[model samples]
Target: MAISDGETWVLASHNAGKIKELRDILAPRGIALKSAVELDLPEPEETEPTFEGNAALKARAACEATGLTCLADDSGLSVDALDGAPGIYSARWAGEPRDFGRAMQRVHDELGEAADRTARFVSVIALARPDGSISRYRGEVAGTIIWPPRGKGGFGYDPVFCPAGERRTFGEMAPEEKRQLSHRARALAAMIAAEFGS
Candidate 1:
């Protein structure tokens, strides 16, 4: 396994919720993990044009900064009606202090009954060694948007997106339940199978 049991690695993210989700998946594999914020590491700007590129950018920056093996993910909601908008700008809509409520409202307003509420959450994860090259994995969850956010569990657009064939939005699902059906989870699972072989 490239990154296996008993190994401590850096998770290049500042979001506590994201870190918690990572632990929920990685901890059972006997991997000890740490986040960039936990280590007080600088977060690299996501300047890349695509999810894979952005993930690689962050992973490389974290690995170079701390000399630790790092893993990073870049994910966003892409609405078909919006022409795949709010893709890279997903985080930007959160504003300086990160208010997702406002972001959600903006999406609703922008969407305005376009008939096609089809959307998908896409995640690209990159694992980088101290030397900075990386292996990448991608995952996506297709769903449709529902007006007025639902239960409050996940961050971002979770409250309004209902996965295909499911009535509950991600925000309505428990953490473990979300893990079972999440873009991030799929990405992590793929990463494990690709690099760790388990």
Candidate 2:
């Protein structure tokens, strides 16, 4: 599962945020990343029930399309009070054109004065090879949702998610700061350790 320096891999995502974060992390290690959008690849429907399954599905699709190694991630915010209502359906909650503001409001509305505000961001990264082999890694960061959604920086539900031991939500943090604590970063770390070494 080792990757060599200077290898180009396809990122199985069209999300600008995820692509930037992954490129920032992997580029220094000498890996070049291209997004599915850049390659004009079709996005596969994520019909899997879990994060790992969905990630693998996307990665496999990209890998097969390009005959190149591919990386994909399935990530979401799960609220404890809601019993993880939007776990795998995170993106779907945002609807078309991805209106995260609406999704965040729905979370708050459903919560409706509930005492438990605990939640966690979950991510699973899947690496797929041209031959169809796949490896998956999972990461999570526990946090709580805040009302009145703070900052305008990060995409998705970052404005309301305050990680444990942090006063500010992810949206309030700089890109570099948020990257240090993001669920995606943690998952990428595990994948790098296995495929790209330290």
Candidate 3:
């Protein structure tokens, strides 16, 4: 799909951090963006079993509801030791109130042996048109979990997982720096190249 200047795209998510990230990534191409929150879009049910399923659900819902091009992303931290768990349920891992600290602690507890601490952040992005046509992209970054939670910059599992070749966790890096190396960013880059041609 060719993206033309002035074309508006809806990002099917209400998270401010995600909205900001999408805006930053797509703004340079002259695409206008609107978030789900801004459009008062309903939260679509993520009953799907995989990231691809969840992403497509949101993208389809947003496109059908607004009659606009839409993009949706579903991402999570999957630990090798946890049997790829906390996959679709990452957001609910901490229960009601969404305490990421608690969720991280749970992960640490589940993987008692530090040798089993290896993990990766995975992201899947789906883009859909009002007519139901869709395209998907995926990306991941390998890392290991730290016990004490090292940084203060990012949200969720950022404070504990340190990406390969980096001493500091993502939470220690500036948002822009993190964006350059994050799984979501990598997926978005691929989507852009695939849809728009480098």
Candidate 4:
């Protein structure tokens, strides 16, 4: 199915940062996003083993609940040095309140001066329709974890992720800049291109 201009889609996420980021990305296309949190939909447990699985699960849940077209994003950082320790568990590592500062510290401590700081951020976008059809797209960006986290922009592990070939971290980059290179943005672009064309 294709999304036309002015179509409304439910974003199956409660994170304010994610909602804002998605809104910014879709606004130019005249697509309006209503987040699940705004609709008072319950957050489903992410029991899926992979990003694609979790994204589809959440999108399907939201579509079933609201009977509307829904989108879900399951994204996280995977550090090569740690053998992708925080891949799916990135959010859990932060605990209930979602203190990313502590999570960043844990990464630093766990790394413990390892020479290899290579990491990559992965994003899977799942779109579910009321007709019970679901489609998924995946994007990834390689980067290295930096010490002493920089910048105040973006969220989650952005402060510590410096995408390959860039000296600045994701948090240090402007929204427009990040959008140009981020995994989430890439995934969204791929999905839109496939479904909506150009």
Which candidate should be chosen as best, given lDDT against the real structure? 4
187: Cα error in model 4, Å: 0.3
What are the RMSDs of all candidates, in order? 1.1, 0.7, 1.2, 0.8
True-structure Cα RMSD, model 4: 0.8
Q: For candidate 1, give the lDDT.
A: 0.89
Q: Give the lowest summed-lDDT range of ten residues in model 4.
A: 1-10
Q: Write one digit per residue (lDDT tens) for candidate 1, span 1-198.
A: 365578888999998888889987998888788999989988777888999999999999899888988889899999999989799788888898999899889889999978999999999999999765689999999999898899999888899889988999999999988888899999999998977787
Worst 10 residues of 1 by lDDT: 1-10
What residue runs in model 1 are displaced by over 4 Å at the alpha carbon?
Answer: none
Q: List the residue pairs that clash in candidate 2.
A: none
**lDDT (Cα, tens digit) per residue for candidate 2, span 1-198:** 687999999999999998999999898889899999999999999999999999999999999899999999999999999999789998899999899999999999999999999999999999999887999999999999999899988889999999999999999999999999999999988988988677
Taken over the whole model, the C-alpha lDDT of each candidate is 0.89, 0.93, 0.90, 0.94
For candidate 1, what is the total of clashing residue pairs?
A: 0
Clashing pairs in 3: none
Q: Is 1 or 4 the stronger prediction by lDDT?
A: 4
**Error at 68, model 1, angstroms:** 1.0
For all candidates, what are the clash counts?
A: 0, 0, 0, 0
Ranking by lDDT: 4, 2, 3, 1
lDDT of 4 at 117: 94
